[model samples]
Target chain A: MNILAYIIQKEFIQIIRNKAILPMMTVLPIVQLIVLSNAASNEVKNVNVVVVDMDQSESSRTLNHKIIANDRITLVATSFNTNEAHFYLQENTSDIVIEIPPDFENDYINGKQPKIQLLVNATNGQQAIVGSGYLKAIVASFNAKLIQKVIPDISISKQSNTTISSRYWYNPELKYTHFMAPGILAQLTALLTIILSAMNVVREREVGTIEQINVTPLKKWQFILGKLIPFLCIGLVLFTVGIIASKLIFSIPILGNLPLLFGYTTLNIIAVLGLGLLISNFADTQQQAIFVAFFFIIIFVLMSGLFTPIDSMPKWAQQLTVGNPLAHFISVSRKVLMKGSGFWNIRFEFLYTFILAFIFNGLAVWSYKKQV
Target chain B: MNTPIAIELDKLTKRFGDFIAVDAITFKVKKGEIFGFLGANGAGKTTAIKMLIGLSKPTEGMGKVAGFNVDTEPEKIKKNIGYMSQKFSLYDDLTVVENIQFYGGIYGLSREKIKEKTTEILEELELTEVSKSLVISLPLGWKQRLAFAISMVHDPEIVFLDEPTGGVDPRVRRQFWETIYQVAEKGRTVFVTTHYMDEAEYCDRVSIMVAGKIEALDTPHNLKQQFEATSMDEVFLKLAR
Candidate 1:
């Protein structure tokens, strides 16, 4: 019976009745979550390597065999010609060419530093970086084996050899979907909120209903909340659907508290809705609102660390991520869902996000002028 | 017994930078009277109505609508008046009854009151059979009529109609004026702006605006008599030229 209730009811009726928007809100997020989660992974697998074993020794043979032992690294060909291996790289038949020099075994046996050259095609940056890393680890393990072969009863100084037994904590197998699903959920919710909130009032303005509504006794907050509440509810529903899918479909771990994640998610939705409201204020029509939302969504999604890690970004870009709401949501989602992060661990992200929400909603509400 | 003034404007002006959109316009309309605002394109008709309807602030003037100050008491004024624009502003996706309910509920009407009003308006408009249909499916003339009825859903003391009958056939336009007449007969002031000259003759009083000022204000008969014109269209043409 409240005025705000009427406005919100009207918005729901319209949203339900809209053919374009209904599918976009319901079917689109489901498909985006499923497709983008699978498609936007960063894991590089099955890098084909050409072993140019010029040494023709046991050490070279052992190293080449060990490298191709895993499913992640496959041996395409073994050749004595370096030029032929280089040709494989150029022709795109191989991603990495591991060349073993003639004295590779003897040099290691004579207490000399031995080197093996790796010609890696860096066209696909992630594959090159990760694939080359796997190759180096294999070669290093071979050097450790050669050191332990009891050469002339020499007691080697063990102080120089510090093997790092690294253990991945959250995702032990480094499952890409587990890492990506929560971030994708955050991205989709933020995106939906931004789009719906941005367009609601703008749609009214385009249809000229805003002119009629503006002349009414409808409070400014009522008009704004009327637009916001519906989108906020939709954002939450979208987030919930994503959460369920991430759990049931992807089997992504729910390490942190559900109530806490839901709380943070609600706050994040409000923050994004605030941003959308700000956009609606500046845009005179629905098309303008969508274009403006698109511009921000692209920047926000890219900077959100959804597809890429924030730590890998340049210093200034990392600093810019501090203001991005999507970035904060993705970080919080991953931490809570993957790392079992408690409130104390994510307190900074929550605080910064709250500040963003405050500023955005405050400015948006302030900029709205019913009289003008 | 005399009717009270529904809207009063003294030196109501609106300017944008160096340009005067509505220049020192002054007028008053009694309650329950039909007032037509006649103007050429860009003749400051919309600007003046905006100020009276509390959508705009007067650059330098005093205005009172429904016994509330335009500038200072805008919130109170807003509650006291209704507005229907030339766009026939209704949600096309919403059914006719739903639209009525939305407007009524927004005006703080109870659910029962909204239902009662919905039934009354639909019956009066002879749209009871199609009340559950989407407004977009309705004919243009019917949409305009529904828009007028919805604008009065709150039972406001005054309803501002901004070209409420534009683009409709003459018969539909005449029918639209009959609804306007019915509202005025129920003692609600109707302030309307229109491009149509014959529509001016239906108003109890019409004000002709030229450039940024009201050049003439009177009954259409007196305007015809003064200008030696046979019809309201000839009188408007003479003043416009």
Candidate 2:
């Protein structure tokens, strides 16, 4: 125990003595939080739209005017030519082209469903999909407006049978940043801690310091613990910094127990640190450590449900999330912070992350060699 | 000094899959003696030293370092020995005093003992004036001397040096060897490995390895006479060839 304390003291001294560590720990998270939280939003606004009104009917012209006036749509060019609209899409100047077929008013006045053509650029899938959805909402509202002028025989009360109302739970405003900020914070915390610890043991090896430290009477578990305790504390402090950033910058509500978030983050950082140290054990250099850690981190982030919804993923990919600690962490971060969930509500996520922490740290300790 | 066998081995070996890194060999080192481990590159000198210093497991046979089993009690052996690797292993970013203190502290020394020993080492190296300077700021020779001193922080029964004077000039090497002599005069066994056969003459006894086997073991003067050679280097050439 005395030896462990001394080793810990020695590690802290080395860490503090390193001039770059302080700035990296404090500055990196802030930059990442500011950039990533804003950039990773699921909301795609300002989609460039090309309008082609062929029928020149009241409804078609009105649709053109609606598309032009909508805040989310950029009316780059509106023309009577269908080919000209296609040209805007080809030039990459427009994300969507709305083509109204001729005789559209005749069908709409008779209460017949009119077919409106939508030419969407599939290159940027998110913008294409969301932009098209917005255009449909506009068309639906216009159809409802046209329903008011529906042949005098059809009564208003009979025509409007169903009107849907939505109340978004957890995030009433449905602010995309509120939903995404916690996930991004989770990602940044994992990324920074992984990169920081991945270089530690390998740096000792690269600089030839491991050769000295290994010969000491330090047990493998003791040495690994010495390494882990400092990094765990560092990970907590770094995560605390990120949590503050999320609140201050994105206004992600701390609705649930704050200590629960921290406790989970502690478990999450341990899993990541264990993974990083495991990489360091096999990697011969700091460069190798970072690269290998980077490869795994990319896998972790992409499959973690951080940027994309796991429910939408293929079944195989969804199953793989079982092994990914970050996925569970992001889930708990969102649940605890956004939904005001207690430990019981997020028990499964908490349990999985805890299990993953043990597996990873167990592997790290098992792989570490005191003698070979 | 009373416990005469500092190191003893019989057919201790290490194999890397298909290739044998250190084949079965045998030797004993006396307490308080400076034993020079001489070899050409890839002659398994490092593999052998690794076994003695408890960094590697011996594949076959048995050995004891400071009366502890190499195979089973490497942890016990670690407590009784000090090691200096081929590369400079002290933290370059740490001050001379801090490095010494850390090494002593890891060996389970108390704060006061570490502080006392730190001062003693700094003064003995005549580095008290620059004790606060980062080790990186020191000359390579001073860094090496400091590394050697740091290895001795535990005041162990035997010190294993894996090519400690690797890349220095002859003058620096001689100065470092003089420090080794002073340490051995205190009746501590010194086991040092080097490719520099020229330094072999300074040892009380020497062993030359080639291709995973010890080719010769004797005092430098006796080995020279036995090989009809003028110097240890000439004797090394004959044996390695």
Candidate 3:
């Protein structure tokens, strides 16, 4: 135990003495939180639209005005010809082209349903989908208004009798930043802990200090524990700072339980650090360690369901995520922080992460050869 | 006078696939002798030292370090000996005192004992002024001497120095030899490997290795007489050629 303390102390001293690591630990996460959370959002805003109104009717103009009034879409041009609007869409100047067929106001007054065509740029499939949804909402509301003008009593009674209201449970606004911030926090902690621990042991080998330690009477498990403890502390400190940044800077709420978040974070960090040590054990140089760590971290982050919904993923990919510690941690963070989930809600995540921590750390210790 | 045997090797051999890094070589060292291990590059001096220091396992042989079996009792051997590598292996980011304290702690020295030893070491090396300075800031010779001191901080029965004075100035090299002699006089065995033949002359007895085999083992004077050479360097060249 005393020797372990000495090793930890030496590691801390080395870390503190290294000028580059301090700022990286403290400042880089905050910067990533501030920049990546906002930047990583998929929410579409100010979508450019071109409207072709061939009807030349008051109702058609009113529909065009409604589309323009909706803050999500920007009406870049109003044209009478479909060809011109198609040209704008083809030129990539417009994301959506709306065409109202030439229908007399008489047909609308006579309760004849008129059809409209919408051409969306599907190149950016997600943006196009969201833009088309907004367009549908605007047209639906405008159709209800036309009914109110045409038949006041029927429209009022129909609206009063039946309504379907959606209440977004956790995030009423559906702000993507609120969803992304916690996952980004998980990603940053995992990346930093894995990379730092991975590079550390290999660096010792390269510098020949490993030979010095190997010659000593230090046990293999003791050496691994000593190396892991300091980084674990650092990882936790970085995670706490990330949480604070999430709450203060991003206005993300910490709703469920702070202690629960911390508990799961500990398990998550152990799993990542263990995998890092495993990589370091196999690597002979710092460069090889970094490259191998980079590869794993990239795969872990992408498959972690941070940016995309896991349910929407292919079946095989979803099955693979069951083994990803980051996936489990990100789920726990979102559920606990946003949904106010309790321990029982995240018990499976905790169990899986604990098991991952055990297997990975055990493999790392086993792979580290005391003899060599 | 019967000085107890500190190290014993009987047919210690290490083979890597088809190549024998350390062939079946046998030797022994007395309790307080400076035993020089002389070899050219790739002559397997390091492989042999590694096996003795419990860093590598011998493929086929029997050996004991500090009276502990090299094969089955390496951990016990580790506790009884110290090692300094060819490269200065001290943590450059740590201070001189911290490095010494760390080694002392790893060797299971008490806190108070480490404190006392730290002071004695810094003062003995005349590095008390620079004890708090990072090791990388020190000169190469100072680093080498500090490394040697740290290896001996535990006061083990045997201290292994592998090319401890590789690149230092001639004056520093002579000072390092004086320290080795002082250490041997204190009744602790010194097992050292060096490329310098003159340094071999400083050893009480020396072994010259060629192609993973010990070609000759004797005192420098006897080796000179036996090889019909005037100096240790000529003896080494004659044997190497």
Candidate 4:
């Protein structure tokens, strides 16, 4: 235990003494939080949309005005022809294009549903899907209004009186910040844990201090656990910062128990730090270490369902995400922050994370040896 | 006379998937001896040293270091031996005193003992003025010497130096050897490996390894006479054949 303390102390000293690491640890996270949170809204609003008004009729003009007033689509410019709209779409200047076909006024007046076209950029496939749903709703509303004005006799003849009301289970206001801040906590955990823990080992290897430690009476398990404890502390600090940023900066509520949140977060960090150590063991050079860490981090974060809902993924993809610890933590964070879930509600995820953390950390220690 | 042998081995061999790195070589070093383990690059000198120090396991052999079995009690062997590598293993980001205190603390030295040893080791190196300076600011020679001092901070029964003076100037090399001699004078075994034939002469006894086998083991003078050469360098050229 004393030897472990010494190792932890040395690690802390190195982290504090190096002026470069201090800002990277404390300042960079805050800066990333501020910049990325604003840019990371799940609700895609204010889509830059282009209009190709082939029909100069008043009805087409009214349809375009409805789209603009809905605030989901912004008509940056009006294109005269399909060629011009094609250029805007190809150049990525517009996320979507609304084309009003010629003779659209004749078709509506003749009691035929006018056919309109929505040219969507599927470059960001998920956003395109969501944006299409949004656009369809707006167009549907416009079509209803058109039918009421142009053909009122067909509208109310078959209608029956009914009442409908809805309530959101969590995030009653549906603020984007409430949804995002908790997910950001998971991202911060993975980023800080992997980078910090890998750096801890790789720096010693680069500087040749590893040989000094290897010669000591220190057990491999002791040394590994000793290294992990400091990073665990660092993870805790990052988690605290994330919580503060959510409550104070974003004004999101933390409705669950703080201690349970911390307890589960600690278990999740073990897996993250273990991944970092595994990367360190594979890389002989620090550059290689950072690269391996980066590659894994990208895969982990993308598959973690941070930017999209895991439920929408295909069965095979969802099965693969089951193995991703970050996905579980993200769910835990959302449950705790948004829904105010208690220990009983989060018990399964907590237990899963604990076992995964144990297995990953065990493999990491198993791969490491005293040999050169 | 009563001090037991610090290192003992019999039929110690290490193999890497059928390639013999150290081929069943047997040797022993008594307490308070400056034993030189000499070899060319890839001649298995490092592999042998690693096995003895418990950093590696022998494929087939029996060995004991500081009375601990190499196979079962490697950690106990670690507690009794100090190791310094060719790369100068002090943390360049840490100050001289910080480095010393860290190693001493990990070695389980009492705070009072660490304080006394820190001052003694610093003053002995005549580095009091720069003890608080980062090791990166120190010269190469100073770093090597500080590394050596740290290896001995726990007062182990034996100190193993693998190519300790590989890249230093001759003057610094000579000073490093003087420290080895001082360490041996204090009755601690100094087991060192080097390629410098001239430095081999400084060993109380030297063993020459060629092709993973010990070709000659004796005092430098006797090995020279046996090889019909006047110096250890020519003796190596002869045995290398």
- Chain B TM-score of every predicted model: 0.97, 0.97, 0.98, 0.98
Off by over 4 Å in 1: A76-93, A105-112, A147-152, A156-164, A314-316, B1-3
lDDT for B199 in candidate 2 is 86
Worst 10 residues of 4 chain A by lDDT: A155-164
For each candidate, report what fraction of the true interface contacts it reproduces.
Answer: 0.87, 0.90, 0.83, 0.70
Clashes of each: 0, 0, 0, 0
DockQ of 4: 0.64
Higher DockQ: candidate 1 or 2?
2
lDDT for each residue of candidate 3 in A1-372, tens digit (9 for 90 to 100): 998999999899988888988887779989999999999878897699999888989999899899999888898999988888989988999999998988746678877878889999999988999999999999999988988888887735654667788999799889888999999989989889999999999999999999998999989898999989999999999988898988898799788998999899988999999999999999999999999999998889889999888899999999988889999989999999999899999999999999899999999999998785
Candidate 4 residue lDDT tens string, B13-101: 99999799999888888999899999888999989988888888888888998999887888899999999988879988789999999
Quote model 1's iRMS: 0.9
Better structure of 2 and 4 per lDDT = 2
lDDT of 4: 0.86
Candidate 2 lDDT tens digits, B123-180: 8999999998988899999999998888988899999888888888999999999999
Estimate TM-scores for all models: 0.93, 0.95, 0.95, 0.91
Instruction: Spell out the clash pairs found in candidate 3.
Output: none
TM-score of candidate 2 relative to the true fold: 0.95
The Cα local distance difference test for each model comes to 0.89, 0.88, 0.92, 0.86
Q: Could you give the candidate ranking by DockQ, starting with the highest?
A: 2, 1, 3, 4
**Candidate 2 Cα RMSD after full superposition onto the native fold (Å):** 2.0
- List candidate 3 stretches off by more than 4 Å: A80-87, A103-114, A147-161
Give me the displacement of residue A22 in model 4, in angstroms: 1.4
Cα lDDT tens digits for candidate 1, B1-241: 3769999889988999999999988989999999999999999988888888888988898989999999888889888898998998998999999999998988889888998999999999999999899999999999999999999898999999998888889999989888898899999999999998888888999999999999999999999999999998998899998
Residue pair clashes in candidate 2: none
Better of 2 and 3 by DockQ: 2
